[model samples]
Target: MTYELYYWSGIQGRGEYVRLALEAAGAPYRDVAREDGDRVLSAFGKGIETPSFAPPFLKDGAVVVGQVAAILLYLGDRLELAPKDERLRLWTHQIQLTIADFVVEGHDVHHPIGAGQYYEDQKPEALRRAEEFRNERVPKFLDWFETILERNPAGPDHLVGDRLTYADLSLFQVMSGLSYAFPRLMERLYGDYPKIAAVSAAVAKHPPIAAYLKSDRRLAPNEEDIFRHYPELDP
Candidate 1:
């Protein structure tokens, strides 16, 4: 069955992580919202017995899953983007959860007051938050990921085992987002996290991923998306 993915049109946002896993694995799926954007709102807390709180939900037959991490976890196992061993699978899930946390924190740097409020209204708070995020949280998270890659018994090429996993793909997306959102900071710090950069490069160059990135299926990053570049905030 071709999976139907529900997310806002014109931006990757959280849905991009799910899209990455699907594209990497060459799974059959459709961006439902991209086709008929208004159609996506129909699933928002209404039609399905288990309603999604927001977009980026997956409908694979009767199994409807929301949340980027949960959707990726479900797809990881089914798409063979995870290790067969239960332990490794759980480890991948753990990593994905951490990535989700990192994403939220990164987003809050711009919208420090509230997600609903305009960034302009909270520009002062955003500046402070962005400072902390760039100085403290950025290094902390990247360092943790770097350590994970360094200590992986298999190698630094992949986040888990010898093969690529959904976590690895997600990490790649995270790195790319960071770079886009904070190019100046990333340009200075990315060298400090060589393994993470290597993994990001590998994911970008992966045959299927590379193709999807070039195709119209891929949505380019924009200020409206999860990773927004603000010269003042980032600097």
Candidate 2:
């Protein structure tokens, strides 16, 4: 059965994380909203037995899963994108959660005062937030990923174990978004996190992921997305 994924059409946002995992696994899925924008709105308005608070939800036959991490958790076993060992699987989920936190912080940099407020209205606050985010938070998050990769008993090729998992895929998406959002900042700091960089490179080269990246399905990062590139903010 082909999975149905509901997310906004034009932006990658958090939905891209789930997309990466599905693509990496070569799973058959339809990006529902891309084909029918109204479907997502209907899902939100009409609601389901188990409604997701927002888009980026998945429908698998009878089951509906919400949240990027939760959707990956549900798909991990089925797609063989998670560890078989219970402990390691949980570890993978933990890593995804951390990545989710990083994503939120990245988004907040542009809308520090409030998400509802335009970036122009909050430029002063965004500048301040971006400074700390670039100088401190980015490094801290990347450093932790580097440490995890170095400490992984299996190898540095992947995050949770010797094999690929959703965590690695999610990390790749995070790194890609960061580079797009803060190219200068990442260019300056990325070298220090070689392991994190390696993971991103590996994921990009993965046959399926590479194809997806080149495909029209992959949306380019834009100012409207969570990872926005404001030159002044980057500087």
In order, candidate lDDTs are: 0.91, 0.91
Write one digit per residue (lDDT tens) for candidate 1, span 100-184. 9999998999998999999899999999899999999999999999999999999999989999999999999999899999999
RMSD vs true structure, all candidates: 1.0, 1.1
Give each model a TM-score: 0.97, 0.97
How does residue 98 of candidate 2 score in lDDT? 96
The 10 consecutive residues of candidate 1 with the worst lDDT sum are 38-47
- Cα lDDT tens digits, model 2, 1-235, are 9999988888999999889888998899999888988456465537567888877889899898899999999999999999999999999999999999999999999998899889999999999999999999999999899999999999999998998899999999999899999999999997799898898899999999999999999998998999999999888
Model 2 poorest 10 in a row by lDDT = 38-47
TM-score for model 2? Answer: 0.97
- Candidate 2 achieves a global lDDT of 0.91
